[model samples]
Target: MNAREEILRRLGETPAEPAAYAAIPRPYLRRHHEGDAVELFAERAADYRAEVRRIPGADLPAVLGALRGHYVVPDGLPADWTAGADVVRDDPPVSIAALDALDGVITGCAVAIAETGTVVLDHGPGQGRRALTLVPDHHVVVVESARIAADVPEALERLSPDRPLTFISGPSATSDIELSRVEGVHGPRRLTIVITD
Candidate 1:
């Protein structure tokens, strides 16, 4: 037989077997450990270089008002929250340049993950649209204690799949080849998370 005929005959004689795939052993631990969710969240969030404050509900409005500089607040934020600072209501959709010029954006999170020290925003009520949060140089987030989840899985369970979610662990930063760190490359350089009771 010619070389091509010989090779084809050999290939036809070979067995055709389906490859077997071994199932990976996934030891999915639901939670890492047990601890006070709020305290753990504060501690973990602090470790990420984020300012975490446990504020009482009574002091929230005052604290928000006290936040220095001009800030853009979402449409549905409580009327009593601000105490006559240079606060602008983003009713008519603030321009991107306007948002960038503002001092920071104040928002309330949809859920907080204690284990990962993450603040998740669904852009609901007090939380403005995505641009309002991203364009500013600073971001001040207010998270309620009751909304803090024990872990990531728990947090996921709390959030709706359809909404636009932003998960922030710490300030925006990056490291270069020489290990030099730079802040505010893409997002806010400063992040302050206020955990309210």
Candidate 2:
């Protein structure tokens, strides 16, 4: 038989109705503990070798000044936040290759999951697009105290489902090749977080 005739005969013999499946039940816990979320987050992030600093809003400029590197900042980032740092504004959007040549990218996060020590970015306002943060060798993020959530479920409540989300727990790394730990394989090698109260 010809290939086209055999395919048509098989198609005519197939069932027309779609199959149905049973629904699954979920009984997962939202939070494991109720300890101070911010403190726990700092401790957990540090465990992944991320440089974390917690300070009052007034002291932000000083902390930022200490980081010496050419960086890319989102257009919505506060002017005073990057007072002394050399920065490129992503107003026109930076090309992927150009971003790789920069020292780092600085941005503000959308929400933080304290339980997982993860910083979630929705690319809103001060948070730049994904490539801006991923291509650079280093990343410096500003996380507000008010936006921290005790756990993942709680954090989800504060975020929009449709937005592009990037969850960062630490500097990019992988140990998959030879079971040896390696950093900066998929993203930045260094991460600095400034938690503001």
Candidate 3:
């Protein structure tokens, strides 16, 4: 019999034993100390070669100015948050392409998973479209401790299935046959996450 038919035949002969499926061991859960989210995020980002920064809400303007590039696409970010930067509107048909041509992308995150050091984006207002972050060479994500979760499951619980979500662990990279790592293979070469209190 073919592989598919053989599998079906085996299934037909098997009894529905609940304990048979329960042989797998439960996953070990890690416990994080309180007040360690920010530190854990920084540590994980650094491990992945992403630059991490901490800034006050008011100093956001200054941080944007420091990043190189004449064009800046602020994803669904607030007007005041991008007042000084050159803003790209979403009305134009080529807006997505235009954003891809920009120097970098900046946006707010829906959640930050401390255990994985991952940032989750839901494309919410001031967060902009997913393409804005995907095509850029650099991505600067703003995360707040209030929205940081201790683990992936906790972060997933906060997200809805209806939204288009993007989870970023670090800068985009892939290894070649020679075992050399190449950055910016499919996404941004540089990733910077700024955590605010």
Candidate 4:
């Protein structure tokens, strides 16, 4: 080895022990308001211009029937949820062109936050890949009442940190300088949330 390389190698070989990280104090509140997570979530979701519908588990078939166009769903979705509707299952992951041509997409969320009206998907069972939801013009999200949380922290606690998470508050929209609202800019133009008990 050269003299300079040997000297550099010797200098780099320090026997320093790793230090333990200090625990940071958590002073923030977990939840601010506490009434009904379902109610709060519905209210906030509506405020974001998303159509929120409440239905019983048994009525899913009827509600889905009213939705128009060619429907697509994740492979992990329950068979009974689709009922008699002709649905294209995304088992092999559809292309962007295919998803765009579809009328709408149906997905089940990992968790719903009442405080922020946010629905989170972790690409888990029933919730398809990110592109499946993004490319479609209409998105139908089914959220069980039992999976609702009061705040972000509660929702985060229930989700796995390593999973790919998608948090959606409302339909994709943007406004021009004169405040002319435009919908379906980068994501779905319409978001329909069905809350089930």
Candidate 5:
């Protein structure tokens, strides 16, 4: 018999066996706790190697100014947020190739999943095209406390099927067979999260 047929015949004759699964350890889970959204956001950002900052809404424009030359891609960002800043606008023929040439991207998140320490992106105004955030070297995300959810399930409930969604968990990273960890292999190398109180 062919290999495929032989395997299938053996499987058909064999009885299903109960398998024991070992519980994986999660030190990260132990680190999480019920806390204020702002505080929790700050803690999680730090854990993910992201620089966390707090700023008033009025000061947003000034913050953009400081990040000059770092192409700013603001999603759902207020009109005044880019005042006096050298920001590039995302025009039609949406492609991230142009965004890849930028130094950084900034955007407001749809929701922050605290349990997974993840940020969800919806391609809304002020938050430019997804490529702006995905291809850049740096990502600066703004999260309002009200937008932070307690867990992934809660955040998923807030999302709609019709919208494009991008979920980010820390900066991009991978490990080699040698167990060496490397960062920024696929996405932004640096992530900065501003949690507005």
Candidate 6:
């Protein structure tokens, strides 16, 4: 047979088989050791250098009013939540440069993980687009006590995979080769979480 014919003949003689994927073993803990979810969440968030505040729902408006400078409010946030700040609505969507210039942005969260101290945003209701929280120097997050979970897996169960999810462990930070830490490189320099009872 010619070279081309010989190669085709050899290829036809051996058919490729599909490889089976082996199931990965999962032996890691699914949840953290039992403890007060709220206390654990606060402690973990503090460890990451995030400011955590426990405020009663009725007192939230007063606390929000105390923030200095102009701030933007995402849609669906309760009107009472922002009482005293010079607030602008993010209707047509603020420009990147404008967002940077603004004092900060405030939004509500979808869920909070106590074990990892992660706040998940799904761009729902009061939670605006990812840029609103990332571009500004300060990010103010409102999390309800009922939404806090004991661990990551618990948090994951409440989140939908299709929605765009942002998991914030703390203020944006990165460490260089020499172990020097830099904050706000990719996101807000300050992260403040208000947990409502």
Judged by lDDT, which candidate is best? 4
TM-score of 2: 0.83
Q: Per-residue error at 180 for model 3, in Å?
A: 0.7
TM-scores, all candidates, are: 0.83, 0.83, 0.77, 0.86, 0.75, 0.84
Candidate 6 C-alpha lDDT tens digits along 1-197: 89999998988875444332124445778787587898899889888899999999999999999999898888888878997777898988999899999999999999999988889999988999988999999999998989999998789879987899999989999999999999999999999999999
Error of 4 at 118 (Å): 1.0
C-alpha lDDT of residue 68 in model 4: 75
Of models 2 and 3, which has the larger lDDT? 2
RMSD (Cα, Å) of model 3: 5.6
lDDT of 2: 0.89
Whole-model lDDT values for every prediction: 0.87, 0.89, 0.77, 0.91, 0.74, 0.89
Extract clashing residue pairs from model 1: none
Which segments of model 4 are wrong by more than 4 Å? 1-25
For lDDT, candidate 4 versus 5, the one ahead is 4
lDDT of 2 by residue, 1-197 (tens): 99999999988885544332123334688787688888988888888889999999998887787777788999899989989788899989998888999999999999998888899999999998889889999999999889889999889979987899999999999897679999999999999989999
| Displacement of the residue 3 alpha carbon in candidate 3, Å | 15
Residue 70: error of model 5 in Å?
3.1
What is the full ranking by TM-score, best candidate first?
4, 6, 2, 1, 3, 5
**What residue runs in model 3 are displaced by over 4 Å at the alpha carbon?**
1-35, 72-75
* lDDT of candidate 3 over 1-197, digit per residue (tens): 89999999988896757687557565766445466777887788778888889888888777766666744554356666666765555534236566677878777889988888899988887676767777878888878778888877668769987899998999999998999999998899999998877
- lDDT leaderboard ranking: 4, 6, 2, 1, 3, 5
lDDT for model 5 comes to: 0.74
Per-residue CA lDDT of model 4 for 1-197, tens digit only, reads 99999999988987444342124455789897789999999999999999999999999978887787888999799888888676899978788899989999999999999999989999999998899889999999999999999998889879987899999999999999999999999899999999999
